[model samples]
Target: MIPSTTASAAALELASAYQSPSLQSHSHRVFIWAAAYAREHDIAYDAELLFVAAMLHDIGLVPEFDNHTLSFEEAAGHIARVFATGAGWPAARRDRLAEVIVRHMWPEVDATTDPEGHLISRAAALDIAGKNPDDFTPAFRAEVLAKHPRLNLVEEFLTCFKSQATRKPTSSAARAINSNLDSRMLTNPLDAN
Candidate 1:
């Protein structure tokens, strides 16, 4: 189940206000995907923390929160930290929230150390690039898409990454472009199916 918490609700609200509907839906699906993966792997995770991180993990990509210098994930981490602090989370928990968001962009995260981070990283990859589509059944995938349709996400996200790459050539977004992220996204099986 999606975590029910004041902070979690607020995170969704924040993303709704600043992000496109496509992006907002993607954020919610991130949590759902992560939660499912956690269950499949028997990984213990903080639901509320993971939910909140998923809701705001792409906040940096929203034009309102987009940074002039910081990479998008770094900007997202900072935003999550500030949001968590306002929610009355302890400093360490706030740090963890930020760390989880930033870690989504990383290639790997040890679940034993940061279950939330590992789930988010894997789930975000699944959603964005269609990695591990077999991890969830076809019916489950259909239901997810029915509830949160792609709604032009492929177009919007690719454009966002291109813009991000031009402004921040050293950023992961740029690296993704160099690594043919566009082709992977365009040919993503999820979008096709």
Candidate 2:
């Protein structure tokens, strides 16, 4: 079961406040996917931290909190750290949470160092790009998407990433867009009409 702590609740509230409906749904799907992956793989992790990290991984994309100069991942990491610190999380915990948020954007993450980071990274790719649909049963995917429908997520995600790329040309999102936006955008299994 996904753990619910005060910090995790606060993270959800912040995500709701900043994320668009599509993005909010996406965040929830990320959590569901990550948790499901953990359960299926028998990977022990802190569910509360994973929940918070998955929910707020895209917080930097929110216009109100975004610093145009920094990559969205970096900005989101700083914001998550600030939120965790305000919630009285220990420095180590806050740093770990920040690492989870920051690393979600990476193409790959080493699970040994940060299992939460690795799971969230894999889960986000699965959610966004349909990278490993076979890992989760079709029933699991149906259940998750039924609870939080995509709401035209592919288009919404591309638009958001395009905006970020435009503002921060050197950002990871920009590099990704330049490299293969169309292929990634086209790969979402949920978007099939």
**Candidate that would win on TM-score:** 1
- TM-score of every prediction relative to native: 0.98, 0.95
1-193 in candidate 1: lDDT tens per residue? 7678899888888888999999988998899999999999899999999999999999999889999999999999999999999999999999999999999999889999999999999999989988888999988988888998888998999999999999999999999888898888887777866
Cα lDDT of model 2 by residue, 1-193, tens digit: 4466788888889898889999899899888888888888888889889999988898888788788799888899999999999999999999999999999989899877788999999988888878888888777788888889889778877887888889889998898789887587687776652
lDDT of 1: 0.91
- Clash count, candidate 2: 0
**Runs off by more than 4 Å, candidate 1:** none
